[model samples]
Target: MASTRAWILKSRPTGMPDMGNFELREREQEALGEGRVRVENRWLSVDPYMRGRMNDVKSYVPPFEVGKPLEGGAVGKVIESRSPHFKEGDTVFHMYGWRDQAVGPAEKFNKVPPLGVSDEQWLGNLGLTGATAYFGLLRVAAAKEGDTVFVSAAAGAVGSAVVQIAKAKGMTVIGSAGGEEKCAWVREIGADAAIDYKAGPVVKGLMEAAPKGIDVYFDNVGGEHLDAAFATARNNARFAICGMIDAYNGAPQSFRYMARVIAARIQLKGFIYTDYLPEMGDFYRDMGGWVASGQVKSRETIHEGLEATPQAFLDLFTGGNTGKMLVRL
Candidate 1:
């Protein structure tokens, strides 16, 4: 029985997650039970939505228990398996956590294929990020071909996918990113218009880009960005409510955009990715083909070592990573 190094949540974060809320500690590995497999994490994903899980309130996922493993989605290889579904050397994706190793029931994870994607992609494009974008923009927003789609946090994990997926469906995309570099990356990735939300008034910028008004709004960072998206949206537009990074730390009930939904007759849908697992196949099918054919592209910002997971996640809030951010464990 040996100990493993892991990052555990020491307390719930009220706002932006600070390094103090987590502790890098040693804990002995638990014995594998029947049908369980041991895995050494190869890569860990950090996303904007993870902030919501740090609070004590209810969400799509449960809050992390104090002094317990901080939950996260990860890609790992089977170090040992006691089940028929997997074997040593097999790869998998699971909602494990920020640790060097983990053990879960065989049915607790999905087998990761050695497809055209890398471990980073397992935590990114082909993982929850891709799934979020695929289902959120296309299904919830009901984005039709030729629609002008606008997304906030456009250079982020989910937003990047939305831009590409919308383009593939023949929709025009306009994105708002944090800065000039991110704006450039958004435009390079297929957005018809990439506005730097950090530049000036976001609402005015989006209006200049889509003067006729936007048909679809894939919101990732809410607060002021949501306000702007609402102000510029077309009548009867579809607004897909995703992560609200900007509002995640604010005072309760502080941000509101409901009036615009009623005034414009907009169809706004708030979604949690877990609720749409039935559509995962459709997401993988389309994303896999596009990846194989080079019809689409994804970027990964990788940080090495298990010790880096905490710091790597910080970058997600600061707009430090250009695309899907990952930590090589």
Candidate 2:
């Protein structure tokens, strides 16, 4: 038998999650079972969606149990295998994160392709984050060439992907990030304009960036950003509602311009990546090619060790990461 350390959800969060909501403890693992593989987790993803899962509410995904190990995306190397599907030293991606090791049936993990992208990227672009942007912008929002697109939280993983994908489609991009540094990086990634949301009102920024009005809005941060998008949207503009990071913490916000949605005849749709699973092959082929050709780039803010998971997750609220936030375990 061997021991593994995993983070357990000790309590549901109130307004914002703190270290008090989680517990890191060691647990014993039995020898490999039939059809099983033991993985040494190398990287863990800390995403905004995981916050929704922490609450005991019914939603798209089930909530995290109070006494169980928290889970998300993870990439690992197999240390031992009792199944033919996986072999020792094989790299794989799975949904058993928040831990240093994961042991289960071999089918629980999918083998990572021998692509040039790093293992951590399996949790970011070229993975769910990129796929979310791909389907959200191209499918849900129906972004088109020459269209003006707006992305909020534009320096984060999904938002950054949207900015690049919009450019690849020949669309004009206006990205909104928190500060000057992130806004600069957004522009470097091919955005026609980057708005520092903290510098001024988001609606005012969007107005200046797209004085004629934007054709598509990718909603990542919901509160004022959503209102601004609605207010500044061109007629029949499409809105792809991705994760609303602003409201994920249960913050209360008042909106006065929802009438703009009706006035503009906007098409507002919310989607999950799983809804587009059938189109995943197209996404990987297209996005992977973009990365290879330098048409799109992926950035990550990596934290060290399993113990840093809590802080890394908390950092999402503080705009601590410029792109994807991951923990190297």
Candidate 3:
């Protein structure tokens, strides 16, 4: 019998998580029961949203158990199957990350579509991140052509996608990243302007980037970025509230310009990517065309081996990744 190494939550984090809170253990594979599939994970995703799950609190998703293996998104190839839905060597996407191998019911796995992109691209641009950008910008914010859009964490997985997608739709986009190199990459990926928030106050950078005020805001990093968006929003601007990575680690956030929401008649809506599952076909069709045309680029920061998974996840808070952060096993 084969055994797999997995990372589990050894203790619930109080604020920011550390290596001490996690433990790696080996577990023998169980017998492959009927209607079950075994997979060898190739790429595991490390997202900011996963930070919320580390805390022992209630939210949209359940908190990670103290002693169970941590779970997120992963792309793997089937090594064995007892289910008619899958076969050996089939590539699949499932929510069984933090481990090198996964065995679960067939219903828990979805075969990755052959979209002429690399297998890892499924985790970066064609998976949760891309879907979040697609729904948040188009459906929630209702961003249209000619709109001046502001995106925070513009060099990240979802934010980069939002920048490119907005540009593809003829919207003028301004993006905020932590450093000069990240901001430059944001511009190279189709943002009309890039703000290096580390250089100065975010509100000052945003004001200079879009002097006339922005029509739409796709917020990934909240706190100051959200306040800046409120400060410079044009009349009737729409804001799509995505991940608030700034406050994910128990950081306090103050919004002095929140009064602008009523004064400017701004619309703010929080959304989850799964909420638009019925519109996935449309997301694939549009995002596929943009990617094939060299309009939407997929960028990633990958760590080698499963041992680096915990560090890769921690790097998200420190702005260590320029794009999607993944662990390759």
Every candidate's lDDT: 0.85, 0.93, 0.94
What TM-score goes with each of the models?
0.96, 0.98, 0.99
Candidate 2's C-alpha runs over 4 A off are none
Backbone clash numbers for all candidates listed: 0, 0, 0
Ranking of models by lDDT? 3, 2, 1
Please provide, for model 3 over 1-329, each residue's C-alpha lDDT reduced to its tens digit, 9 standing for 90 to 100.
Answer: 87889999999887899999999999998789999999999999999999898887789999999899999999999999999989999999999999999999999999988778888888878899999999999999999999999999999999999999999999999999988999999999999999999999999999999999999999998999999999999999999999899898889998999999998999999999999999999999998888888889988999999999999999999999988999999
Q: Top lDDT: which candidate number?
A: 3
* Better candidate by lDDT, 1 or 3: 3
Poorest lDDT segment (10 consecutive residues) of candidate 3: 113-122
Candidate 1 ranges with C-alpha deviation above 4 Å: 251-258
> Model 1 over residues 117-205: C-alpha lDDT tens digits?
77678777788898889889888999989999999988988899999999999999999998889899999989999989788988789
Best of the candidates, TM-score: 3
